[model samples]
Target: MNEYLTSLDRPIEAVRYAGLTVKLLSTGDGTEVIHHTLQEGSRWSMQPQEGWTASESIFITSGSLKVTVDEETKVLSTGDVVSASPIKQGLVFLALEETEFIYISSQPVFQFFSEIVRKNQELAIEVALKDGYTAEHCKRIMQMSMLIGERMELSPGDMCTLNYASYLHDVGKIMIPKSILLKEGPLSEEEWEEMKRHCTYGKELLEATDSPYMRASGTIVEQHHERFDGKGYPNGLQRDEISPLAYIVSVVDAFDAMTTDRPYRKAMSVENAIEELNENAGTMFHPEVVKIFIDLIPEWSKMKQGV
Candidate 1:
């Protein structure tokens, strides 16, 4: 007698596995069992896709499968299981007259992945906002930085580099201790030291991620704290020793900090902030950077209005 079971009786539900119809026998939180049967000549194409935050396993029940992860490719025979992190997207090709396999995965895997990517994007936005305080502030600083980079006759690529550098100048502050960052009173010397560490901290954070734009950003972070006359922390290298990109970031960063309201002080007027930067030229900021920055303030304000 042929043996066939009803879905309710066997707990096997229908599903699609790598474009093939399959049956999912059961599913629970972070775990599921699926059975798939493949026809002869059926093929599977896998991409480097990983779930946001779960693990996946595919076990061959009959026939075989060809799997490729990164640049490494392998073939798995019947009863063979492949395991990988949920975030890893791999390639799979099917082989055999009738192939069967059990695939397992986390229950909320897709939800978890979506949530993480959403939050990570938000974090990127938040980091940008926190650096400039307001959208307008970021706009003004970016315009000003771009103007200075342009005046220097930098290549289009360098100008793009400068813009991104200014945008993420404070990306390291994500690692700052909240107590110190949010404090309203004058920071103790130790707290001040902690604040300075954001530059180093930001570089390290960017490097740890998969961002390709972070290479130049790493230098900006390292030099954003450096003073024109050389009394900077983490590294005191003075004068032309500081990178040009670092100089641009330093000028933009200081301008935004002074002209924007913070917990400890009211914002200085734009005019006063500009004057202050001019006064510190050659002493605290690169004189050339200060000059170009001053020229861009009006145009920067126009962009700020939109933000």
Candidate 2:
């Protein structure tokens, strides 16, 4: 590993295994993410070892591959996401169509999972915002969620989890087609159903990557769409049935959506968004989270006003 022209000037360069090239995205920042590209017919045979952990999450951006994790072997197609475990699992990247993926992890399956996961998260946030939400939305939700978590007196580590979880709350929306996403009218029932699938799809997409944060994030993503009144789709879980993270996200997500201009609706003034949230509290959102969210509205308003 050399530091010249490497991504971010990190002290590590590329880890090569057969026809796959794994580039370290960062190191020690705890946001481990990686960019992995595999050539056709590449195979990584794992030799059972100790003291190191590596989990391979393959997001087939293009082409196909046959990945065998332990005793299970699965064929991954473009857009398919899968993960390798800490246990001895050999992977054969047979590119059925010349595959590419942004591989992410907390500890490199071989040498750098931490950097991979962190960098991948940063990139994932960028990819997710490709829908036009902007990375600023993630920053706001992260700040707001941490503030809410503090009010509830959550543990530091738990609050950190909430921070990243909040940043990724809308990650599932990445899979939504941009046409429907940017449509200037109320979503058709079919479009609505497609949107609803993001909750489940996002979780399924991350289930294999083996990042604990991503694992925990799966639940939040799955339930962020739920309503306080059990009216949300995919799962109509209501009130306390939803996780606390989801409760926090519901408030933040709604607030952002209303406050930000979308193709279908003009942006409501912050005051109006807050008033709507307040009016619908305990019906559309958790009342407790609403209080905290409402309090932050002032700061958010100032930020939006560029004050």
Instruction: Give me the candidate number with maximum lDDT.
Output: 2
lDDT by residue (tens digit), candidate 2, 230-281: 9986789998898877888778877887777654457788778878998998
**Which runs of model 2 end up more than 4 angstroms from their true locations?**
5-106, 109-132, 302-307
How close is every model to the real structure, measured as TM-score? 0.56, 0.60
Candidate 1 segments whose C-alpha is farther than 4 A from its true place: 1-132
Local error of candidate 2 at 33, Å? 11
lDDT of 1 by residue, 211-293 (tens): 33344456776678888888986789799898788888788778777877754468799999998999999988889888888
Model 2 sits at a Cα RMSD from the real structure of 14.8
